[model samples]
Target: MTFSSSYLFSLTTFIYMGAAALYLIHWIFRVKKVGFLATVVTVGGIVIQTVGIGLRWIESYQLGYGHAPLSNLYESLVFFSWVTIVVYLIIEWQVKQRVIGAFATPFASLSMAYASFSPNIEDKIQPLIPALKSNWLIAHVVTCFLGYASFAVACGLGIMYLIKNRFSGASEGIMGVIPDCKILDELIHQTIVFGFLWLTLGIITGAIWANDAWGTYWSWDPKETWSLITWFVYATALHARFVRGWAGRRIAYISIIGFASVMFTYFGVNFLLSGLHSYGAQ
Candidate 1:
């Protein structure tokens, strides 16, 4: 990577960290201006992040081997963070709620910083192996990570929901800053629904890609199994919400568990288990 690109990445990391801190203060103090400032800083960080990714892409070409940056764990994680922020921004805009971004931005910033700084994670662009030399790779990975990002937002909302619920009955100082429990519950449900749709599409795309590349649509690989498990968890959540009239704390708890599965699918399968997706790690 060029020095300029590395510097841009570093700058973005710092901005995100600052934004997260601002958002946290807003949450704790119930200060609207702090949240607004946090949003501004977060947007600035995202713009810098976009430039950084673009510079990395350009640098890849300069190295005489052109490939999208989604090939490895580090790049994927950075892209995942980007997607999470994008999705969170959209939700924040739609709901007019700055509180969720308070939780989401820190996670995004932290993940990006981890990917950028971890010595074990290689930042160099490399040629794709023969197995990965297909268009399906991009589609499959993007969809999967988008799904993961959506669930990450859902997880944040779930956390807020639990906190809101804990203080629902009591007139605590912090409770005044949070939205109503009903609103939190609804937000959690909406995020889960959005995440579930993307996750379903992601899984289907992966299955199709696997069939094209390896002649098997469904192999019980660790990654695949974990993804299936995540699907089931959210599927159950959806059913309970729509069919069984489940809401509030129960659904919030499910969202938490669903996101935990998302983490396991993303990280656990990469490190804790062996599978066809092991090559995903850089």
Candidate 2:
């Protein structure tokens, strides 16, 4: 086993926790330096996580497994955390919003912590099952997790909206630090749109992969079925916002609900339901 990857990931989890704390401090105290510290720590964590993923990929090659570091549950969760932070950082940079980090970073930290601490998860590098030994594996997994990461960010924004709307009539105090409700609403819409596109690609790639392995394009497996369900949820959200003039609390609630569908597609399908995608549970 390559210890480096595990070590880096463990460090990443704690660093994320620290970053989250810093973000909250910045929000509560209105301290500019603390917010910058949070941003620096999160960016540093992302850099370390990139290195860790690379090391894990190399170790898989050395073990002769010869696949991306995405064959099982542990690595997927790690990648989900990684990309969530990446997307969040880009948003933070462009929008100049640090309070979102207070909501977003904990999801990244929690993903890593669960992957590291959960007894049901294993961190070993293993050869792919015969069905997964295809080029589509990487494409499907990466796109799906990118989509998942965006949904995670959107969900965090949803929480922020709820909190901001529930209080702060004048947009003062902690609410003053957060972006405006209208801005959060726009961000939530945009994030879900980004996620929707990638998720479409992920599902298409999975269909192609299934065809190559099983001679069928759509099997209606629990995973595939639920993925379609999640897709429709986001599609409806987008439609409602653009066509139906939905905004604010309604969009925020739907974003949170959409993420719940995402979580079920990613996690529930593996443990609570079973099908060809059961390999992920390993």
Residue range 137-238, candidate 1, lDDT tens digits:
778888888888888888888888888777778665766767787787788778888888889988998999889889998999999999999999999888
Give a tens-digit lDDT track for model 2, residues 121-198.
988888888888899989999999999999999999999998888885856777777888888989999999999999
For model 2, name the residue pairs that clash.
none
Taking all chains together, the TM-score of candidate 2 against the true structure is: 0.97
Cα deviation at 154, candidate 2, in Å, is: 0.6
The ten-residue window of minimal lDDT in model 1 covers 1-10
What is the model-wide C-alpha lDDT for candidate 2?
0.91
Cα deviation of 78, candidate 2, in Å: 0.7
